[model samples]
Target: MAAFTATCCGRALKMVVFLARLVFQLLAVYAVVLLLVYVCQRSLQYFPDKNHPGDPKESAAPSMREVELRTEDGLTLNAWFAAPVKRDGKIVVMYHGNAGHIGHRAVKAQHFIDKGMGVLLVEYRGFGGNIGSPSEQGLYKDGRAALSFLEKQEYANAQLVIYGESIGSGVATQMAYEIQPRYLILEAPFSSAAAVAKKRYFFLPVDWLMKDRFDNIDKIGGIKTNLLIVHGDEDSVIPIELAQMLYEQANHPKEFITINGGHHNDLYDHHAGHVVTEWLEKQIAAEEPAVKPEE
Candidate 1:
């Protein structure tokens, strides 16, 4: 009995040692993964297309001209600009999702232009044949450059509508909070890049590993402008729950719309443009001064 007990004890100790080594190895591998994630998070997050988005004239938006916007960082980015139709007189500054360049957005942009709203399709650094790399601060500089161009055009904050799509919502949120545009619209926006990364990389320590937080949830409260949050009920990319969370935290004078079967990129096909146009017009009318009958 004593000999048998000794053998069993030895076996148990060896098993424990093996398990400890395995756990240690896994932890080491995970740490390496985390390091790699931290370094390459932006590359994974921003999927830009160096290929031109195609010509605006080809996209049926003949008024949009290829223009150069100078950033505070001294980088001149290629952007699309169009003055609003005289009837509408509203300038819409659009920051597109982090994917194919601004040209991919010309179709929806034309919808706004058709409504007589001027649109500025701002392209970021390192996107659409523009020079430089993309980062949180770099994108902000690009946004500032867009606004500066508008400022030079004599457009007031009240005449401006700031729009962001997907990741671009981060840029839009920051700009709206800073400038207080007439309306601020976000489509399929994540609460923050860290939150989205955590969703996709549940196994990793994303909150700490992510360098660009985007942190839209934290900043939404600071936005006092008229806010519009749109999400698709079936949005698989950035779940509607995230949009709901954002809307819940937003200030009043805000609106939230859920497309019945909207996905990340197809909201436009689901008549999202119509929704935006209707809401913008309603908000504008409500804010317009009442016309009293002449005495």
Candidate 2:
């Protein structure tokens, strides 16, 4: 009977050991996965060349002139300036989404030009074959540099309109907070990069793991400039809810426009340019002093 009891105890001890080994193996695999995610997190966040053609020259329009901007951090950034056919003394400094170079946004520039507003399509450091890598701070520097270049051109602060698309919204928010442009527009903006990352990578601890926390929500409250947020109700990338949340947090003189049946990349197809141009005209009219009847 004692031998039987001893054998049973030995079997229980072996089972416990086996369970322990299994747990350790599982943990090791999980740790390796975490390591891999950490190493490649930035790559997932930024896609500078996504859908880009082989030649950067293809992105330029006939009226688009190449401009060189020098960032405060000593990076030479490339930009395309599409002057308005009829100058309205207003310029839109466009900060494009994460993917692709300025060429991807040339059409948007054309839209601005057609509206009699010039466009300064600033390319981030790592984008558009520019020098230096991209990071949250690096993008901010790039934004400031673009603004500085514009300032040197003697455009009044009231004539400068800041426009951000997708991830560029974060950069634009930071700039608007600091520089306080006459008008600020964000297209399909997220609340924060961390929030989006958490949703997309629900299984992982993305809040702690994300490096580029473009916390636009925290900064939007400080932007006192006139704001316009254009979002697609059917956007799957940066959901419309995020844009709504941002609009709610923004100060007065803010407008939120939702395009029906518009997805993430096709808001332009849904008359986004018309909406923007109309809003811009309203703002410009508001700035003009009331015309008094001639005596």
Candidate 3:
């Protein structure tokens, strides 16, 4: 009876150890899956806005001129250079958020133009009517391509501003670090994509699992341009605190606009284009022009 009792205890101990090992293995696999999901989502950001038929048309007239551009990677990008009715020299290279083509930005573009700022709305490769797939690198390529398109036009009298919304913030931040624009405007921007992922998956070890940094906090400091960050106080999609964090990470000559009753989607619900355009104009007025090299 004693030997039998000892044997039973040994078997139970072995079973417990085996189960613990199995649990550890499952956890390891789960961590890997989370990482993979982060990578896939980051990769998909490149081609975010796939063309969809029956999308709502813009309220603006057909005043904007359509332009085609090609990135160095052989991806074609579509752009609309909406010239103001008065053809002002100021140009805004605007980047729409993660999930919409340039067409969806007609209201924003019109607002900029109405403020005497020409708007160059770019379509990332694989988004909208553009060709090729989107990756983080691909979006950066498209941004450079958009800058190149505008530079070739010698819009010398116009000041260049970059406006990036949501996911476009990463792309715009990257560009702003590389080139000196008049101002860098980020709407609903996150400090980093990794940080945002961690928030969404609090239980998961997302920091270790994420592959794409999209580290705006690191990039914002290198930008010398005036910075404007806009976020709603009650933004649910991206918490208002993240916007404040982004602002804190930035350097001097930065401003934050707290939109009252502004949810992420309804920032301009009441003011429509009037408020944004006016804010942009104020930003432009406050900025000192970039110093160009001697001719």
Candidate 4:
């Protein structure tokens, strides 16, 4: 009986040691993964194509002029200004998504130009062959620079609109909170970068691992400007629920447009321009007092 007991005790000790080693190995792997994610997190967040081979001039409208904006941090960014054909005194400062250069947005700019609204396609740092890397703060500065450039052109705050697309929504929300533009439009905005990351990487601790947490939900409530949010029902990249969460947090005088069967990149393709232009015209007309009848 004593020998049998001894054998059983030895077997239990071996099993415990083996289990402990396995646990340690797993922990080591997890730690390495976390480190890698931390080091290269921005790589996954920003996908910039420095050499945008396509010439924007070809597709640009006649009034579209290529301009360069200098951020407060001394970074010279690229931009394209598509002036209104009629100079309606309204301008849209567009902040694009993570991918693609400013030229890719020429069509969208043309849409606004056709509606008689000037469009400023602002490129973020590290995008469109611009200097400096793109971070949350860098993007905020870039947005501010774009707005300041337009302000210098004599566009009043009420005459300017801020448009945020995809990841650019965070930058737009921040700018809206600070400047309170007359109109703020967010397309397919996530509640927060961390929230979206958590949804995709539920197995990992994305909340703690993410460095550039563009927490738009936390900032949207502070934006008292007239807000318009556009999200597609079929968006797979940033879920519509995230945009809904943001809409719920926004202030009054806000509008939400749901595009049926629209994905992340095609919300505009689904007649979003019509919806947006109609709302913009209404807002502009509402601001303008009715002319009195001639006596």
Candidate 5:
């Protein structure tokens, strides 16, 4: 009987070891699959040329001078600078959203130029025919590089206005901490990238695992510029309530405009450009003009 019991115990131990090894293999496979999915989603924007300019007529507006910028990582970023017939040392550096490149922002940029302000439309690291992939850190570097490039030009002394739309808001907020633009504008922004990810992938525990935080809510309060937030009440992607939450966190001298009947992609549909231009004009007009010494 003792010999029989010993054999049974050995058999149980072997079974436990086999089950452990099988579980380990399953986990290893799961990890690799998860990694592959992440890499694919992160790189989906760079593959194929889907972001090209769909409307050629967008170029019919006043042409903007093309500007090329280099990030700290040596990746080239493309930009378009539309200066007034004569610049008065005021520039608006606009950052495009995650979906399309700067080509989609031509109408918005023209409105700024029409308002007597130089507009700089910057492409993120991987978007708009730029080299490398788009990440939170890369975008911050790209935005700073654009600002540095602008600082070297004739409008170096111009008041800098930073504008960001959609995912670009996070980049804009990070740059605000670094460069402290004279004015900051965010359109259809989210509270945080993680927050949006959580909403989209509620089935999985992605909020904690996501390497890119893009936490704009944390960075917005530190910005020392006049903040202007515009959002569409009918936004289907990011709720308008979150936009209000972000606006409320801002300090004094901040404004919020709700684009009537607008959606996430149609910010310009309900007079967004006109509303933004009008607000910018009033803000710029309110500031005390810089005193220049007569030669």
Candidate 6:
């Protein structure tokens, strides 16, 4: 009986050692996964070249003039510019999301064009068949170049509306902070890239690992332009809560529209574009002085 008890204790000790080894082995494998995620994160984030319907610009009218943007970094980018249908109407400088190029948004541009507002479909470097690899600062340079082009065309800050979608929201916020466009609009925006990544990759240390930290929340408070935020409650990509959190950080003269059951890319199908443009048109009209009853 004593011998049998001793034998049982020895077996229990071996089982414990095996379980400990298994746990360590699992930990080692998980560490490797974390390292890979850190290294390949950028590739996972920016989708500059996405497969889409044949030529995003094919549906656009021939009147749309293709222009060149010379960045401060000395890179030349291709952009499409459509003059406002009515002279002196507000111009929308569109900074689109990460995936696909400006060409993917010709239909969206037509929304504003149909509204008689000029649309400058700003194409970031490495998108829309342009040159140079995209980075956080690179996109800012692209945004600046777009504004500079308009300035050269004699457009004032009051005549420009900076519009950002998805990742472009950071670019738009940054530009608004610097120049204070007449109005600033964001669609499906995130507080920061780090914040969104943390939600998606909770197991990984995304805050320390991410290189391009598009921190919009810290800068949105500094922008005093009339702001509008459009987000879909069912948005699965950036999450609607992120937009709400960003809106909370913004100053007054700001508005938010939560599209019910709206997903990340289908907001336009729900007439979000028409709704946004109409709101801005009203805001612009309201700010203008009323016609004199006698004069």
lDDT of each: 0.89, 0.86, 0.76, 0.87, 0.79, 0.88
lDDT tens digits, residue span 33-123, model 6 = 9888777877888889732223434766444678889999999888878877766779999999988887777878888888788889899
Residue 74 displacement (Å), model 5: 1.4
Model 2: per-residue lDDT, tens digit, 1-295? Answer: 9999999999999999999999999999989999988998877889886332323345544477778899987988778876655444788999999888888888777777777788898899888788777889999999999989887877667778999999999999999999888799999999998888877888998877888999999989888988999999998888899889889999989999999999989988899988998999899889889999999
Error of 1 at 1 (Å): 3.0
Clashing pairs in 4: none
lDDT for model 2 comes to 0.86
lDDT of 6 at 6: 96
Evaluate model 6: give its lDDT. Answer: 0.88
| Candidate 5 global lDDT | 0.79
Q: After superposing candidate 4, which stretches have Cα over 4 Å from the reference? A: 60-62, 86-88
TM-score of each: 0.95, 0.92, 0.84, 0.95, 0.81, 0.91
lDDT (10s digit) by residue, model 1, range 9-89? 999999999999999999999889888878887888888898766677777677899888999989999999999777338
RMSD of each: 1.6, 2.4, 5.1, 1.5, 5.6, 2.3
Candidates sorted by lDDT, descending order? 1, 6, 4, 2, 5, 3
Which candidate, 1 or 3, has the higher TM-score?
1
Runs in model 5 with CA error above 4 Å?
Answer: 1-33, 44-60, 154-158, 289-295
lDDT per residue (tens digit) for residues 93-200 in model 4: 899987988887787777788877889988988888887888999999999999888878777887789999999999999999899888999989999999989988
> Which is the leading candidate under lDDT?
1
What pairs collide in candidate 3? 89-158
TM-score of candidate 2 against the unseen true structure: 0.92
Candidate 2 Cα outliers beyond 4 Å, as residue runs = 1-9, 50-61, 84-88
lDDT of 5 at 135: 75
